[model samples]
Target: MFERFTEEARRVVVGAGRESAELRHGHIGTEHLLLAILAETEDPAARVLIEAGLDRAAAREAVRRLLGEGDDARALAAIGVDLDAVREAVESVFGAGALDAPSKEEPRRRGWFRSEGRAGRSPFTARGKKVLELSLRESLRLKSGHIAVGHLLLGLLREGDGLGARVIADHGLDFAAVRRAVEVTTG
Candidate 1:
């Protein structure tokens, strides 16, 4: 399916991985895909996003914050671990902000998007994968031979339950509005 993705579309996919990695996230969620699409400033999808009031980096930050800024802390709490308490204990022993310091071990930054393997990488979530699949459907529906950025954005819009699509809706954009915007930009 990826064979039909245009170079720009492929970059968006890879960029989603990089975004997830950079954010220290364990999975490439649909939100990361939205960020990747927004990062592609030259793409029509991105331009449509800009017009819809969700331009690049600032919008990315908003999406992350909206998706629960302290997600890891909450996750730890769910497993009967108080992250803040643990952090306080560590800080009392090592001094304040001890965890903020970088480790001497510069961990190797391997990309998750590498095709050879997916193990131990930030794998895409089920919804994220679904968005990619939907992109193919979108391309076919539009009578396009290749999956482009617009198609990818359309996929995000179509998958309305995903956080990425929810974010778009939160920003006051419905799927139809987004589709029309994409069409205008592509034309």
Candidate 2:
């Protein structure tokens, strides 16, 4: 699944894992992915959420509540999350093969390894990564070829108990609204 994603998407997954760990959480689920998406503020998907009036701070608070942790830095340190394990798990979830050398003589595809000077590293912050992972898993469950912005929107819905979801709901946004927007725009 990671292989099928663009470099940006892969970064989202990685970022999500790190953020999940910071939150003292053990799983790289959809909630983390949604947060990851938000963390990457400049990304189109993030822009969409922001435009939809999703409050990042509020969402974070909700996540804290969902995790049953108080709003303190100590809460983050309580969990011993394995970053590398999270990355590996993200790769595994996406069906990515080992990160080894490609077959000899295989022609490198255009745009492969080309960052387009956007950034040497991913723009996805740790929180954004969490959201992205959640979205990616959901997209896979729906058998999508690649993770789309729409998937991210839907992932926010799946995190119903989280802060982000509540904010979205308060804004009168839901999976159906997001899906309609995506369909109208993409179609």
Which model scores highest in TM-score? Answer: 1
Q: Which tens-of-lDDT digit does each residue in 1-187 have in candidate 2? A: 4466656666656666555655655445455666666776666656666678764665566676666432344444468654446647877876553432243453444532222223222233334444556667767776777776556656556546555566566557676766565444322
Question: In candidate 1, where is summed lDDT lowest over 10 consecutive residues?
Answer: 111-120
Off-target runs (Cα >4 Å) in candidate 1 are 68-120
Q: What TM-score should be assigned to candidate 1?
A: 0.72
- Give the total clashing residue pairs for model 2: 21
lDDT of every model, 2 decimals: 0.78, 0.56
Relative to the true structure, candidate 2 reaches a TM of 0.51
- For model 2, the stretches where C-alpha displacement exceeds 4 angstroms are 70-145, 155-167, 170-172, 183-187
Tens-digit per-residue lDDT, 110-180, candidate 1: 54334223433477888998899999998898888899998888888888788888777777777797889
Most lDDT-accurate candidate: 1
